[model samples]
Target: MKMKKKSATLLTTGMALTLALAGCGNGSNNNNAASSAPASGSASAPASSQAASTGNGGSAVEITFWNMFGGGEGDFVDQIIKGFNDSQKEVVVKQLRLESNEYYAKLGTALSSGKGPDVAVAHVDRISPFVKAKQIVPVDDLASKVGLDLSQITASNLQSVTYDGKPYAVPLDTHFHMFYYNKDLLKKADLLNEDGTPKLGEMTPEGFEKTLAQIQSKVPDIQALAVNTPYFQEPFLNLYYEAGGDILNADMTKAAINNDKALSVLKFYMDVYKNKYADLNDKNPWDSFSNGKAAFWFGGVWEAGVLLGDASKNIGAMPLPPIFGSQTHWASSHLLVVPSYVSAEKQEASAKFMKYFSEVGGSTWGKAGHVPANANVTASDEYKSLPYRDQFIEAQKTVKFAPQTDKYTTIVTTIAESLQNIIFGSESPEDGLKDMEKQINEVLDN
Candidate 1:
């Protein structure tokens, strides 16, 4: 039910891997305006008021922002909301920190009560449910107002937030996957070229196996791979894609667990983590990698964000090694939104503040280890020049996203569990998946 970081150094080091930031804008709170329309029917529409002002007959537009981020990510968010507060503020964004587990339950309760954050941070995966519930507004209005083109965001990442033909939320950034191998070990094992990085293009699942075999033969105590949850399961989809298995038919109503391609992926994992081709019995694979034991791992740009602390002195990165014909990174993004409950006055003020957040705050977020979707901000001299951006951007070009469906929570929860069984020896890959198909398809049937 919970995802855990690996136990080894490379894995444990990833314990800090998070995709959050201090947030958007100048992070300053100043001028306050009255609500766009008073809810009580007698409030005046001041030229300058709080960003929370809404035109509910002149009531303050109070929006609660529910988020799973609470790191430098929180600080980043604070800055942006503060700016919205400072701008000719009619809309007020009040942010509430929710543990990853508590986020949805709280959101559900709020929505049912008509008291939810006007603009809560909803994931692409969570979009369908909110759409079905009518809790959020289609962002097209705001995007048009600001001259922001949704096409500017990565299509794959954007796909997640789109529902029933309309885009519900804004695309944030690609928190995509990567495969990190120990440069030092690969070199010692003669797996690297003269440049010290492995010949990644040639790093197939078979090749990945051979390289790990080499490491295992030479270093008996060290595991050659790590199987961090959720992240560990991510590669399977790409591998399945490579193996030629379509997760669902166009209808999104059926499971293709029976596909031979997906099965091969499971078998591959069995060899690496369960069948014993390499030693992978660790609590955290990334830790094994960072500690210099595990040779290859599947992680993401967000994973590297955690390493932002002592990056220069600590580690290295690479695109995910080839398991399929071409490289496909797994990723996600974050966005800033204006909810429908806010009045037109607050919407205008919130939009202005959001613009500032998108501009200045975007780059600040990049500093906290996230790639910003704000083009002007992301392309600035500082962002493009940062060492982290230079290395991580390579993966953004080919990243793929998990299908964002209202049922994603149920889907991921079941799949992650079944995948654990396949990797940890509780069941055979094929056997586990056949059973998994039944369970997943049931959700779709509902």
Candidate 2:
């Protein structure tokens, strides 16, 4: 029953967010490396010939890595792995690119069967169940041996991966929700300040509404906000957090979402779609923003690399505005963990790879638009100078992660459906909130 619960919760998040990308490196075979299954020896490693000739006189320990990263993020992971492979002679990390939905379930199953990858990627919030299931091993000793600087990592990020005072995973990056604006569109709408930043008069609900209205009135052809279905639930949650709402009560015994603040936030979200400031049915909201048809986009810092790399676009980024008198932001972190079933040698090798990618290769990952969990890296001149990163770096302080519970995926899934229903006009915010509260409470009670 516990395993079943783990599989259900983990798989839901994996599948919903997995991305596949082109231009992956590190000798990863495009044909064999991509799989929706867990990384067993027979399933997701490279052939012997793919080993790094430069590493350990061609006798490197090749370890399997299972992760859900694709597109630009995928490319960055592959590059980091390739760099580690090239720089070392002791470890050759072979990556298995798994689709998100298939990843967690397969990983849980394989770990139970003692056939999981040597190293795996787990989101900070999602790591708890794996820890409880005893499927992932703590990396403290291995991390120490590899000279991992835990002290240099951000306090909140380090805390996220720590379970029972033991470090179960190495945090790679902090991906938080932030605001992305089209420079030209905001300027045309007269929403720009003297410094060229969006001059949304205040952070109040009315202020935000007026700003959206101004942009919509001036642009006419573009959306004031660009967002897809998968991302629709975030702003609601962020606003709820800003309004001083908590997902769970003090004891984590039940859902605490059916409140006035939540209702107010939900109503505001629905109005965005109703007023035509955004399209509820828009298939590719990022496309609208990317093509200069949207003035404001609320998305992860991961969008930084793509927008900055595009020479045709002028993008400005900022933390999500304080719409409810607080600047709370939604956030999550990518953590590198070692599965418990691996041998000591493999564990050490995996730890070395994790350290390299997260510490030595931290700068490169930062360039991809995520805030590195490594505090020293973030403070470095290189990271500080990256395209719009400095503008939103301050948001790390107020970033609010989802509640840490085994039922997180279930709760998030419930809220997402309810949000979509409200946006689609199939359910009213009041009804949606009631349903969300009931469903979430049921999950918690179970």
Candidate 3:
């Protein structure tokens, strides 16, 4: 994923264009920059009038959908879309895939030009910018029309995509970092509890180190703690939030993470690699844990899809250890939203699809290692019975996200780079904090 250095400026221009065009609301065709065809879909359908359905008992309204998923997650989304097509006769959704790095840019351009897909998947964090710019309309009306019950969705996920008490998107799932342990390795270390969970005595830095040392002493050839470097930012942010600090000020105009609390959090993370409890150079944490070479793995819940398939390894998940005195975890979500300027039939069709995904497809989506955003789905016996989900599903109530600003892409990129520098020992924790604060404040100022 190539990230723009001047993403703050680029995002601002895209959003401004959206606000300007949203006022038009005339549903006129215009230039679309996202039709590069980097990926395939149902068909080469134009963003024109509603397509007449020729399938079952009635005319099915055809609607286009765009999404930014790949690998297993992509397959899961495709399966759900296929299920919808198979179970419905009133709507036909044409799904299009796009490169994630450039998704927002293309989406903003298309919506501003009145030529975007009728429905699209947006990150809960990224939807704020589109909502603020009015590129996506409020979906409360649609929710009401479809008899969608807001109480079924998690409050955090529902609030994440809402602005000024108005809903902008329908949440699909909540993805967060969780603690996974190899049950066999834990049993060998005598750290496996009777409940099939790891036996860490206490949730403190000293206690955590002691538990890791015990595991290391038993499995001398394996890493006691394994974490994927690419997703290090998630745990890092979780630590920051746990330390009673925040990523930005209330006004979202300045960085709020340059204080002692934040520094202490960074030092806590640095000590993990400094004391030799974990290897910072391990490139594949998931493989390390799944292959029984690692005792503990901290990563996104999405790994369940792959890890659950390893019959030789027994895996157990738990909420991240509350060593920092806070139960909060870093999280994000996939949300369904309608773009501005679309036909009434398209709106109805899109709303119906959203309802189906949240109501009918929630359980299937959970199999992809995501906690369903719908509360009923999460509480269902089928969802709770899934391996390792019961251990971490409670995290939805305390999950935290970065501030909602139009410059979100820039802020996260800057913070991720700073964390990587610290993890790779290219920069000291102090230097990393200074760099993060400077870069984040600069983006906020812009």
Which one wins on lDDT? 2
Model 1 vs. true fold: TM: 0.78
Give the Å shift of residue 53 in candidate 1.
9.5
lDDT of 1 at 71: 69
lDDT values of the candidates? Answer: 0.62, 0.82, 0.81
lDDT of 2 at 290: 87
- What does candidate 2's lDDT look like per residue over 325-344, in tens digits? 88876799989989888889
Q: Report the C-alpha lDDT of model 1 over 70-149, residue by residue, as the tens digit.
A: 86777877876776655533455565666666666666655554544445565555666767777766776776786666
Best-to-worst lDDT order: 2, 3, 1
Q: Native-vs-model 3 lDDT?
A: 0.81
Alpha-carbon lDDT of model 2: 0.82
> Which of the two candidates, 1 or 2, achieves a greater TM-score against the reference?
2
Instruction: Name the regions of candidate 1 deviating beyond 4 angstroms.
Output: 1-63, 83-92, 146-151, 229-231, 242-244, 274-280, 308-314, 337-342
